[model samples]
Target: MRIIRLSVGLLMLAMVGTGCISKKKYDALSKDHETLRASSASANSNLQTCQQNLAAATTRVSSLEEQIAQGKAAITALQASLEKCLSGANQGNVNISKLVDEITASNKYIQHLVNTKNKSDSLNMVLTNNLTRSLSREELSGVDVQVLKGVVYVSLADNMLYKSGSYEISDKAGATLAKIAKIIMDYKDYDVLIEGNTDNVPISKPNIRNNWDLSTLRASSVVQALQNQYGVDPKRLTAGGRGEYNPVADNNTEDGKNKNRRTQIIITPKLDQFMELIGQAPKTDGTTPQQ
Candidate 1:
């Protein structure tokens, strides 16, 4: 009986010890599970925050790209405006300079005309008064001719040159042209200007139309005769048409209107500086052909 009781007590003690070990194992397993859950939650939270921040950053980057595009467009427009302004400013500058130069040139011309008027008047009178005494010819019968302001003026009337309005040079007028050409060719000092003038007589035809046409044709005819027949070099000649713009006499009077319908040959001397400059050339021996 004593041995049986001892065996029973040892068995009881073994059962209690096993129960304590099982409870300790259960507590450790529960703690390990909680730790794993906490770590997983923290990792998931961090990943979600990073995604949200990345989305915000991406949106900001996209907005910046749009702003950059707009800025570039604005810059392009500004550049175009600047270029236009520059071009306009440059044109204005050039025009102002040209106007200044023209003003200066006109002043010089006016001064020169004022100073030479008296001496030129004395020489010009000998050639102007009494056309019969100075120039005599049948072709110049009704044609009025005079020398004024250093130019020869040939005024045509209906009785002279042609039947009504024609560009034909008359038979006797050939001698007059020859005489004029001889005088001009004789002196190599002057440059000549042949200007054709016309009356206010309106004309319209297949061959001729208006004063401009008549004047141009007459001028051309005179130029051709001078160059071909008179042996005048073309380089030394220039012809122009006034077309009733410049008139020496009243147009209401028949005789005065006749004087307005005219041609003129103006002779002029080049400035001395031009000749001096040309003479400075080493290849030329101070002699240049006037033509």
Candidate 2:
């Protein structure tokens, strides 16, 4: 009976020890499960971060591609424009050279015209001075020598050239006409115009009809005297008349009437010479005119 009681006590102690071992194993299993749960949560967080990084990388790659495409398009356009410019370079250079040549030719022609005008003005001034110096002071009283628009005008008063109310030249006019004729002959290239002017006073005579007839007859008589008596070239002489017209002053006063009734000898370069000068202008291609 004592052997039997000792075996039973040993069996109870073994059962208590088995319960303690079971409790310790349960606590260790719980701790391992919590550790596994924490590891799973950390792995999930790392996966999400990687996904976000990949998305950003993809977006950046797409932007780079778009920028590269735009750069290529701009480069292509610039290359095309450069090629076009190179192809037309020769023609553009030629056009520019031609324009420059035309401008140069125009400037030269303008200078030529200015030079001709200066020479003409100088000649007119010299001619006027010579006439003024040749005439005596008393002769200069009734004669007015002037240079107007490159032409010489010698105005002679009616009392100095002709008798009162007559178209015939007076005997005193011979010396003055001779001096004028000598000047006209000296300028062989110049043409002479004898212009007669008359006052508004009406005249009645068997030979003279009106102021028109008187003025015309006076101009024609002067022209003939310069040709036949003074030996001036007839081809260079022209006759014209202004009846009660071309007045220098008011016709209401006697002095004005006297001034209105006068003869003018106009001397000018020949028309053919002027035409020749115009024809001698430079060509548009910058070539000089033929001599």
Candidate 3:
């Protein structure tokens, strides 16, 4: 009986030990399931946050692409407008340059005309004054001293120059020619033309064949006297004869014939200086032509 009691005690002890071990293992399993549940909930939260962030990023990308396309279109339009503006500006510059050239040319032409007129008027005034001052009142009345077309014409009666039907210059004419030479010598830039005119009455004499010969000889004689007798320059003198033609009055009347037989001395200014000024080109600095 003692052996059976000890074996039964041992069996009870083994049963109690197994029950405690089973309880401990069950507690550990419960704790491990709770930890796994917490981890799964945290993971699901993280995935939802990631999906929302992806949606925001996609919206921002679409907006940025639309803005880029609009910017490109605006840039293209601006380039086209710039090109058009440049083209218009270039054309306007060309037109302005052409207008400036035309205005400059017109101004040059007008200035040339004004300068020429001024020079002519000034020369004519000087010639008229000098000729009028050189002669006496009685001499001026007998001879016509007039300025026509910038030239001085002195018309003297035939009685002042020569005798009837004679080609020789008289003493009175020589004195008059010497007075004229004084005025002529003062101005070297003048050209002198001595013209002799005669009536239609025919004449035949020694050393004179016809009225033409008489008139020609008279003009030559006056020219020679002006050069040799006075100090007049031979280079500036010219002799001309108009016989029976270009008469101032009718040759039929004696008084008219006498009036027709006259001598004309024409004095003209040289045009070399004026012509040289007109021939020059316009200045590059936009100034007037040189005087």
- Per-residue lDDT for 187-217 in model 3, tens only? 7888889888899998878777887887778
**Top lDDT hit:** 2
Candidate 3: worst-modelled 10 consecutive residues by lDDT: 1-10
Q: List the global CA lDDT of all models.
A: 0.67, 0.86, 0.78
lDDT of 1 by residue, 91-195 (tens): 999988877766665555545555454545554554444333445666456556666556555554533443357777766567677766776675455566778
The sequence of per-residue lDDT tens digits that candidate 2 reaches over residues 1-291 is 345445545654575668754656555655755565567667778888999999998999999999999999999999999999987897899888988887777777778778877988888888888888888999999999988888999999989999888888999999999999988988898999999998899878789888888888899999999999989989999999888878898989999999999999999999998898789777777665554
Error of 2 at 121 (Å): 1.6
Rank order by lDDT, top first?
A: 2, 3, 1
Better of 2 and 3 by TM-score: 2
Off by over 4 Å in 2: 1-39, 82-93, 288-291
Model 3 misplaced stretches (Cα beyond 4 Å) = 1-113, 271-278, 281-289
Candidate achieving the largest TM-score: 2
lDDT comparison, 2 vs 3, better candidate: 2
Clashes of each: 0, 0, 0
